[model samples]
Target: MAKARLMVVEDEAITAEDIRSSLEGMGYDVVAVAATGEEALRIAEKLKPDLVLMDIVLKGGHSGIATAGELRRRFSVPAVYLTAYADPATLAQAKLAEPLGFLTKPFNEADLRASVEMALYKAGAEAERQELIRKLQEALDKVKVLSGLIPICASCKQVRNDKGFWQSVENYITEHSEADFTHGICPACAKKLYPEYFDQLYGKGSGGTPE
Candidate 1:
């Protein structure tokens, strides 16, 4: 498997450096680092990193959560919040962004490794699920247009579908396709079958009435 590409976004220089070092040591790419939300967005658009470790507080007007939300909506990248505080209000705000993971500050190298690994795994699983659903939908579409061997009788217009069964045209169509049938009389059949009733239904010599 390829190593996960990571972007570190922290306002504190020393903490960012330490995290970068730890991530590199754990075999992650550590593709880019940003001190502000704007820088993070620029690097993310360029690098398209697989995951982002973003500090909740940043140097610019846009917070890390805001940047992460934009990345997710536009690029569909997964992010984990790196913060020193985990108060309920802050955590609730972070949760609204749908972060992959949360890591409190003063964490060790092992903690960072575990958190990153779990976030990448979760992202991978979600992507796999989406791909599976797409493939299933495609298969269903193919099945819709599949032309099977349908048996038909020479005398009557009825057809024999799969399973060696005989049924009316409407019944066979409704069973094989996602179609709903409504009963109605065509102009030719209505005029031939019910001329007197048709005149009674509508005015005299009117075309016909629907069944």
Candidate 2:
């Protein structure tokens, strides 16, 4: 199995190196390390890594939270924040980005492992869900984007097959699409064909003639 590709977005050089080393040791790939929020976003767009390890604060005009949000919005990548501050205010700010996981500073190897594992698992699940939705939408679009005007027999209300044969509308539609039909009678048709039944239920002259 391929190792999960991870990008470390930390401004502190030493900390970034440590993070990269730890991740590599854990059998996860450290694809690229970015020291600024701008650089992080650029590399993320280019590499499309599976997950990002982000620091809440970065050395740039933008914060890691903002970078992570844009990454998710544009590329659908999930981020795990590793920060020293756990203050309610800071966490609340990070919450807006909807990070997949968070690990506090001074974390042990186990904490790192747990955070990375959980984030990767959730990312995998989300990716699977997105793929399924895309496939379903593609199938629905194919059905909806039916070919150009269909030739039909106006009198019989039947359709002309591509093979130059006449076929019922239901059969033609069924053959050309993922659709099924259920028969039902409209009020007009019911009144016209079943006049006795219609009169028994609703007195004569209660409804207009069928078309």
Best by the TM-score measure: 1
For model 2, which pairs clash? none
Worst 10 residues of 1 by lDDT: 202-211
Could you tell me every candidate's TM-score relative to the true structure?
Answer: 0.70, 0.69
Estimate, for each residue in 34-117, the C-alpha lDDT of model 1 and write its tens digit.
999999998888999999999998888889999999989888888999998899999999998899999998899888889999
**lDDT tens digits by residue: candidate 2, 104-140:** 9989889999999999999888889989999999888
| CA RMSD, predictions in order | 13.9, 12.0
- Counted clashes in each candidate structure: 0, 0
Which segments of candidate 2 are over 4 A away from where they belong? 142-211
